[model samples]
Target: MAIRPRTAALFAVILVVTLGVVGVIVHNATRSSTSSSGTVTWWLPDWDWDVATTLVRRFESENPSLHVEMVKTTGGTVANKVSVALDAGNTPDLITESIARTKTYIDKGQLADLTSLYDNAMPASDFAPGLTDVLSVDGKTYAVPYRWATNALIYNTDLFAKAGISGPPTTWPEFINDAKKLTTSTVAGTAWPMQGDPSDLTLRFLDFALQGGTTIKNGTPRFTRDSVEQALELIGTSVVEGYASKSSFELDNTGIRDLFLQGRIAMYLGGVFDADRAVGQKFPVGTAIAPGPSGPGVQEGVGWAYIVPKAAKNLDGAKKLASFLGRPENMASLTLTFPARVSAARDAKFRTDVRKAYGEQLSEHSIPAPNDPRWTAMIPFVHDTIQEVALGSKNPQQGAAAIMTEADKNLGPAQ
Candidate 1:
């Protein structure tokens, strides 16, 4: 009507402000409705950041609406960082951590159940057998595994040739005999980690226990049957007979690996990564499955998985990313170790000699760590007992008894 200039000016200002408010409301509403079109924060170890970045880029290319924010964490500190975040109610959308830790989160109800996603995303038979057990608590899956690292016998081919050993040992008897043959004034036949690090000792012991047919029934460590005592006795005898170095009591896994690299240690049960490291250093290395009493022993390994926190703001986006990362090809590109998916290992890129060895051990002989939340807490007792046996303070029988008592006590009744 243009009755007054002041009135007209006031009306225009009101109209502009109202339109701005409406635009803000519409933007917020669109963002809420399209939950998949948002940023998903990911906390991953620094070592895997390169491959993770590549995977993220690919996912983003396919999902233009979603953005991934990669937060790199140091391996030693990531667990603590994740715990703090969870406690503070500030957890990221996704976390790539050891399966053991992931299980802990599941037990504490901190992570979302991915059982439905796992079932819908891939066929049950496509994954490595028993792979999901590590991330499951009370039969509900909480995470999806991507990469794995397992123990394998890494020997020096040059030293084996010098010792006149024809090939890697096929059984425990041969392993002991070969160790004796490989021992010299300069090099020890084989070395194992006997240091204060309970994890190293626990894993090494588990490899033997599993080979002896030890099983964890309802989260309890059962070592009385299946030649479990014989396995412990074998390790003890190796130490007492001087085939293995006494210094192993002071050395950790890394220390043992270093000795092997320097040609001072002839053989060792080490991670699959050791093969890659040896090859990288131009050292003549040979890989084999750990010898058991009867044949190839069950290998013990730990893996990393992708988990979404219960408090995640971008639940749908996080689930989408988790499923994307689980894709066989994507997982294969992320780690040198065996991929969790069977199809991923069948990819051409995993056909190298080292990868082949790892794949064989994982598929045929691998046993993941016990899916007990108390397993971590029980490592110290197991480690101490093994050290006691190795140092001649106790025999294998006594050591076994002590381990059972301690494990049972700490593990409680088991849920």
Candidate 2:
């Protein structure tokens, strides 16, 4: 099931209650020291559970002294689980989560500083340029980036042909016109994930915002800038005019992707992960950089990073597991995501037209999310304001102004 936004206050309360119960159990277990086996516990999301299990077995076979225990978590619950575990002083030695969310752990001083390991074992230069920086906080490394992805406009080639369109649109006006032409009684011209999940909605907004050169500097949002406002206006107009799917507000990424695979949507912004699935389903998928106000737009790239919490019971073993998973060979074998390591990314499997297109976009036009702890705090506000604009509850100008005000309050004064 898709995760929805929650108030920070509620999350804090859950964390406290969960930690109170777990802390005693952990403290008692550790104090007893009942077992001699050196087992490293890990919490990982369900996306690649099987692949991760295989890799963990291999690592254990290579190092008989260590046994890796994999704890499967879901996308919706993993963050809260990890938070409670950390507060209870019983967090898994290693965990995987989005780089953006991982930063919050680092901000709370809950993550291990992996600078020495990164320097001595996995050199920063071996990774995709700027990735180490993305995973770093205040110049200290805390996590190892595992896989990266950038958003792109994935379209149905068959739909384009039926609509008599030559190719994917490269400008906002063309995009809107093409979307209208692709619309039919049976299928939506385009789709957007307008579900209440802040991360989902905010990422979509950032794609357009970045293309317009919008940046959050010193906690002040630049949404009122002409370029940013224009981008929002385009999306607002498309939704209001019925060029986008009417059910967008109810659907998340997975729901939209299912519709795309069923040929119910002509176009949508998605990542490289969907490319293989589209091909596997025999859909004629065509990918292009997102269209901008006047030309090709910029996209944002982010990834999942592996981290060891500061409260982990098996620190050494955790670091070893992280290092093993980051090896070029293991990374290529286990993950379909674009590898964060430059050397692994060079593998022939990533050279396909779709992957190459995403790579080119990442190298040429992509930007990471704003490097600030409060960025996550601002997401829900941004999501809600965008929803208001898209659903016609607020005009684009009003939505932009409201977003700026909310951002200022949530993000605090510029550092």
Candidate 3:
């Protein structure tokens, strides 16, 4: 999560500001150069520079006929920039971005078909089941899900010991109870991120709602009133009951993590990386399966992927590179977290005590975040309502209704 984590804001800008508007065309597009036949242009996220460079070098050496020109793009800005380039029909041969972003392009027929290459390079059965679904629309693949992660319950063990708590919470009731027990003047029991990136806020809310039967399908939001209210109540009442810090109103995932490390809060529902963050730090950490109302909750698995544009200057070369990157070993190496391929994840790096909960949650209880074209537009409704509800300006009942109302306005009434 952070792969370093984000994009909701970026896509919102793309949908609202860049779509169908080819305003100022910069001479240099964040696009692959169409200068020559053997030059395969790739847009890489800055975080992946080193490892991706090594892989690119290897690719060039192995192929001998093709040279890769990697145009590195920073996170949070890449999506919007790429969207503008796409609107202008200026594209790189390959793009590295969140897999969910592919649906928007595929819907517009802007991506090349990768089904043959994907099957030949990495078979569907080798990946975690359903991982490739995000890259395909109507069973024709368009991208490769290269990286993935799921959330888990990350707790400060020292705090648990000091509070006389025996272990991590195993159920939702126990989770709230633990938060209550951990609360003190010095430390709030837990916290939820209520502000900052609206998309992150939406995902955090869904982290709980997913267990309550909330889902989005084909760009339409879906859930019963009880489930949405229950999800909001857990987040909102935690603050009202004094078991959660009010700082949550201002915190995002990074802010909440900082507070956890500083011991201002005892625990949080966080990404798999959060499970290992306390290593070499003052306090020890523990991870457990994030709990649901009854037991372990279903968490959302999210990550980056490789895509080839239909207008790619080197479509054949782009598909070749995508297939190469999608290989199990390469996928594992490229990902900072878990790879989409199940076989790739059998690598020792993914097998650790701290990451156990991630494995369980992902293999058993996780689902891909829905690929909704309207997700960018719908985030504000979720964000604003959750903030109002948590601050007591509105009750959970009203907050749930607002979300549905917004969803209907943006996505056409849940299909």
Q: Give the candidate number with the greatest lDDT.
A: 3
lDDT (Cα, tens digit) per residue for candidate 1, span 225-342: 3344666687777898789987788788889889999999999888877888898999989888878887888877678888899999898899999999988888888866778888
Model 3 bad stretches (over 4 Å):
1-35
TM-scores of the candidates are 0.87, 0.83, 0.89
Instruction: Please write out the lDDT profile of model 2 over residues 1-415, one tens digit for every residue.
Output: 6445677677888999899979988988885564424788888889879889889989999989888888899988987888788778777889988776776677688999888777555788887757777667677888988887788889999989988999999888898899999998888889888875667767778778766666644222344455546666876767888889888888898888999998899998888878778977778999888887788787766778889999888888899999999988777766676888777777888788767767777666666655465777777777877778888989888877776666557664323
- Tell me the tens digit of each residue's lDDT in model 3 across 1-415: 4532247777777877664454333323323233467889999899999999999998999888799999989988998977887878899999998866778888988888888975545888776657777677788988878888878899989899998999999899999999999999989899987767787777878777877877756534576677778888998888877898999988988899889999888998888666667764745889888888888788777888888888888898898898889888888888888998888888888988888788887888888887777866777878888878888999999999988777677666653
Q: How well does candidate 1 match the true structure in TM-score terms?
A: 0.87
Worst 10 residues of 1 by lDDT: 218-227
Candidate 1 runs further than 4 Å off: 1-37, 119-121, 218-220, 225-228, 412-415
* lDDT value, residue 241 of candidate 1: 79
Better of 1 and 2 by TM-score: 1
Tally clashing residue pairs in candidate 3: 2
Better of 1 and 2 by lDDT: 1
Spell out the clash pairs found in candidate 1: none
